[model samples]
Target: MYNPTVARLTYRALLGRRRALILFALPALLILMSVVVRMFVGVDDRVAAEVLGGFALATMVPLIGVIAGTGAIGPEIDDGSIVYLLSKPVKRSEIIITKLFVAVAVTMAFSAIPTFVAGWILNGNGQQIAIAYTVAALVASIAYSALFLLLGTVSRHAVVIGLVYALGWEALFGSLVAGARTLSVQQWSLAVAERIGTGDEITSDVGLPLATTLLVAVSVAATWYASQKLRTLTLAGEE
Candidate 1:
């Protein structure tokens, strides 16, 4: 459902105002860090790996996912602007799917592309690091978008919950607890990167087949569940 009108509305809300700034900010920071690292350290593949893995994939991608995914519907639900779309004869599922598509595209564009650029800048694509991380970024984009979009549909504190999941769970506990890595998008996508990259350059706690299955399952299930949630979505009274 390529709803041009819904797509247009989603694009405007995504790129308009302060959210746009955050969208630009993450990639800008990545490029800036890449430039600084290249200038001082001079194109070390290991450094490239560190920057991309530590910052780009681990941090920026998830942050952008949070913004795009949650932002796609959270504000609409909050201010009750979703009523405009709901009042139309359009199926609520169409609206959710359309918004989900937009969110995934936005997340991929902002996170994955920049990750590739930063990867190349840091190491000139040595050992296929750029392409590998780029692939992971792309895969992660889909999952993160679906998860956060679902968060938007059901929770008022979508951004907060997303941040906690991204930062606290994935970033913090994932590092500390072995079990946490199994449920992490960061680790799951890293598994993809691991398959593409050279020995030990990219590693993931999760395996390739499991990560692939989980990634696909999570994306599909979240998107479907979001559509169902949107069907019966109710706006809170302005108490």
Candidate 2:
């Protein structure tokens, strides 16, 4: 579980100058909005739920997930720097696991912590809304990191695909079509939040058991598949 070297490299790559700014931007915006909303509208549980569910959970978490997850390995693979790691004696699984851990940690830092802060700002943690959504963000970080890390391993357009899934599929289709909600990461996460939050302020379309199952299954399957892909990854020789 501990791979200090790989973890160090992944953290540096993820929080590099340009990328670090993008990583922090959304959470900053969310907190700012919370402050603005609380100032003008005053404390309201419904508004708090909407702000957290609509913006923090729906938009910020997935986008940060895309950045952390794909960025953990995509850039290395693209620039052919991954060869340095692969050429070593380390197991491919170790490399994937280390990067996945880094991605999950980064995602939680950027998404979940800020979400808690924003939720509290929105409604003073009324009905335990802030804590509930924060839990959802934390749970989501794990699954999203695994899924997008796999995407980074297998596809050149990892970020684009992730954005499409996060924005188009989860945000758009999942909102318009009831069936799509059943398969959405956002909805699944909200299910967890629903269980934690008092009252029906933060409800989800999916049930708790189903959501928990999907979250675990997705995280495990994606991590396993990514390790397999990395094991057989082919690097082209310089011509």
The C-alpha RMSD of each candidate to the native structure, in angstroms, is 2.2, 1.7
Query: Worst ten-residue run, lDDT, model 2?
Result: 230-239
- What's the CA error at residue 82 for candidate 1, in Å? 0.7
Residue-level lDDT of model 1, residues 30-74, one tens digit each, is 999999999999978788888998888888989999999999999
For candidate 1, give the lDDT.
Answer: 0.90
Query: Clashing residue pairs in candidate 1, if any?
Result: none
For residues 54-89, what per-residue lDDT tens digits would candidate 2 score against the true structure?
A: 888888999999999999999999998998888887
* Per-model tally of clashing residue pairs: 0, 0
Best of the candidates, lDDT = 2
Model 1 bad stretches (over 4 Å): 234-239
TM-score versus the correct structure, for each prediction: 0.95, 0.97
TM-score of 2: 0.97
Clashing pairs for model 2 are none
In TM-score terms, which candidate is top? 2
